[model samples]
Target: MNNYKEKQLEKSAEHYAKKVFKVIAAIVFGAIVFGLAIYVLMRLWNWLTPELWGWSTLTYWQALGLFVLAKIIFGFGGEGACKPKKGKKNKKKWKMKCDMRNDFSDWKLYDEFWTVEGEAAFKRYIENHKKRHHENEQKQS
Candidate 1:
């Protein structure tokens, strides 16, 4: 009836209001953190640069600009920068290239490989390289 409909409408309004509050809170918190970072950066630059490098000190806006520029150039690293992706067949390949882990699981048999077949392979490569160089010299002459 009418009462049931009003209750449903109230619940929906409350849910949306909570969501909007969370969004506003997040934006405000982000702004505060950003402002604090810029202030700290400006203070540090003003303290250090004038003394060490005889460089000009930065204002808050200048510090903010520099921070943005540095982020743009060096990248804005965030969460999961090195975290492995799920359901990925290339996780091993990605981990191999990531700087997070120095593990060489595949290279565990490197010594055995070198002892068994690496020397012969290297010698063959050297012989091939020498032949190629000699052929190039002959061609040039």
Candidate 2:
């Protein structure tokens, strides 16, 4: 293969590796968080309701299995309760003109903005937006 083709293949492999790493990292992180939450919940339950802890005891493996079963049932709404759909739906249909535009160019504007004044400006912008959002939510409530 030509040098250009070889370089393209190398970059493609790198991109694929990066995407796979991201997916694996997300799964591992999610598992850790879920385990931690379960542990905390069990500790809290034992602390708050000592009587329940003595009624019947489950081993670590049994507790883990029960937790998984409970998650599958409640998380997926096995009892037919009202369950919100996961993930956002793309509602707005873009026109062909909008589709034709380069997405990188839009991203470049933010890149240029941050580059001009360093990250402080971007950080301030995020903080201001967060504050505004909080205020708006408070007003709505």
Candidate 3:
């Protein structure tokens, strides 16, 4: 029983070591690629800036810093492109909202009608609404 436990522990330790090594290798590789990218950006800046705008040629570190600065200011990977994950519930909600806005006229409300809560409200109204013509007939009777 003790021998079996020892083998299991050795296997687990080897697995853990492999995972750590892989993580370290990925980090090193990422750093190398980032360094190369920075160098490329620096070369392009050097080639263009001094000739076009009378700007001084940047050093390696300056170029890296500029890259970092641009990334910070302009940003990378903005949330503007994010799409909500579609699900059956969302589809149902969209249909409900569409039904509720049968007489949509306002442009601002049109935008609001497409939102989740507005869609929900639209759905609720659709489900509960008594036909206006039906109510009128009963009133006349």
Q: RMSD in angstroms, all models?
A: 4.8, 20.0, 14.0
Q: Write the per-residue lDDT of candidate 2 for residues 7-43, one digit (tens) a residue.
A: 9999999999999999999999999997887777666
Tell me the deviation in Å of residue 5 in model 3.
1.0
Error of 3 at 124 (Å): 37
lDDT of 3 by residue, 41-120 (tens): 99999999999999999999999899889999987854332333454456666656666765456666767667947788
Task: Indicate whether candidate 2 or candidate 3 has the larger lDDT.
Answer: 3
Q: Which residue runs does candidate 3 get wrong by more than 4 Å?
A: 78-141
Q: Residue 26 lDDT in model 3?
A: 100
lDDT by residue (tens digit), candidate 1, 59-118: 889999999999999998764555665676777677776754656686889999999999
- Number of colliding residue pairs in each model: 0, 0, 0
Better of 1 and 3 by lDDT: 1
List clashing residue pairs in candidate 2.
none
For each candidate in the order shown, give its overall lDDT on alpha carbons: 0.90, 0.71, 0.82
Which of 1 and 2 is ahead in lDDT?
Answer: 1
Better of 1 and 2 by TM-score: 1
Ranking by TM-score: 1, 3, 2
